[model samples]
Target: MKIAFVGKGGSGKTTLSSLFIRHLAAHEAPVVAVDADINQHLGAALGLDEAEAAALPAMGAQLPLIKEYLRGSNPRITSADTMIKTTPPGEGSQLLRIREDNPVYEACARTVRLDGGDIRLMATGPFTENDLGVACYHSKVGAVELCLNHLVDGPDEYVVVDMTAGSDSFASGMFTRFDMTFLVAEPTRKGVSVYRQYKEYARDFGVTLKVVGNKVLGQDDVDFLREEVGDDLLVTVGQSPWVRAMEKGRPARFDELEAENHLSLQTLRNAAEESYGNRDWERYTRQMVHFHLKNAESWGNAKTGADLAAQVDPAFVLGERSAVPQPS
Candidate 1:
């Protein structure tokens, strides 16, 4: 499943993004964590040094790079439309490239070894890279389409996006592209206030967002936020002075604590469960009349499939099983 995390800055969006990536890695899943926040810092928060995070451009940065490649060094190409190239990555590479416009962007993909497992991260370089005039340009629809196509076509892969904070065009636009969105909110008053707005903004994009209450000191604080929001509170990450200390450049350890033992991580796992639908695929697929009819024989659910297709889209469904005449 492809999931995106968004919230106000300093609201723990990246922290949760990194932690989720770590959690998925431990499960032996092939996961790609895209740091879409143009300003960066996800790598460092996940335990990478400055030089490491500097090498990647969250997906946003890759867009301009694609434009540059299509334009090339030659001044003759006035428009990028005809000049773009889609260079497919070679076999055995971690990136399953959709297509490449220029080879420059692929340089952003680097494999890093982490404690839980290895992660391939791409960052959106800070807005400082582009001149003010160029930075004002809007994102291309083609680029967004290409990225979504890649995600949809991939096999058994998961994408976790760390988007910029707030209702800005960047965050709103990116948030809409995800199969699911997880909003990270802290225990403070400002955090809860922003989270309410975040939920509204997510709904504007027609997404059902799940909330993660971070840095909670106790159950009362979590319950209070839930009461105020009046939504199903997914999971709360208990106040982890250790995790906070690490983010601040202080050396704090997570030695004895079980990563899964934390409430925050538990909610994230639950969110993953719901969004991935790995556990409920049977019920979900059964409900999908067309999909169920196609796979029922192979899956040994043909009886249910026949009944479902009869109730839903019957003509083609019966024809598919060679048991009835197809429609004209």
Candidate 2:
């Protein structure tokens, strides 16, 4: 399952993402934890030392290699310019398996050794001064999206991503790349407001969003979330002293998390297990094509738009609901 955690900046999304990855790894499940946030703190939350996390390679910096290798030696892809997000893998395109022996994994992923089992960690590099006006954060988002598009994970395998905060995720189509999205919302007006915004934006694309109420202090906090989010609220995590200690640089064990937190985590795990299934590749491909064509019309050229449209699988396009109706 490909899962993403998104919420208000300080709403504990990254913490929940890290804890969930740890939980899966503890069960000896194969998992890849991706830190796609510009802030890049998931590594530390997953128990990596600051220096070790900093030493890991940035997946964003490796975008060229990803594109080159995934495209492989396919002669059909004559020019790199045409290989946009909508470009589907051809016959010679490389497929990524998360296991160590897979060439794609060996070349691009880093193994983070945890207590129960090892999990993979990939990060999008932090925004730098050079990128101030030249590039948008979507450049990094595009890399993660393309990599996942090429990856083929088994049923039990998992990909957990800590995405950028709040409604900013709507800036790019990357939000649609996940199988499920967990919005870790605090019980506050701003938090509920973001949830409304996210739901309204994602509803049009058929995205699944489940809200996890975080940092709940008492009944009032839970009540607020219930009132605002209702059925979308899956679980609630109370404020944890153990989590607080960890935040202060103490070595708090995952097993030592508050009981409520553990239950909330278990509930989340069960939800993911129930939701796991094959991805709708046709739907995803159509969505990608739609996004690319929209971009082409607004900022790209006619030839590029035609090239993107040609990459769509004909059968998928025939049944695609991604095209917006034209106004008469």
Highest TM-score: give the candidate number.
2
- lDDT at 145, model 1: 25
Can you tell me which runs of candidate 1 are displaced by over 4 Å? 57-105, 137-146, 153-156, 169-172, 248-263, 278-328
- The collision pairs in model 2 are none
- Tens digits of per-residue lDDT for model 1 on 113-230? 6555676666655666454667432242224322432232233456777876765533213344455678777767777776677666656444557777877788788887788676
lDDT of each: 0.53, 0.76
Compute each candidate's TM-score over C-alphas: 0.66, 0.89
Give me the overall lDDT of model 1.
Answer: 0.53
Given candidate 2, what's the lDDT at residue 131? 89
lDDT of 2: 0.76
RMSD of 2: 6.3
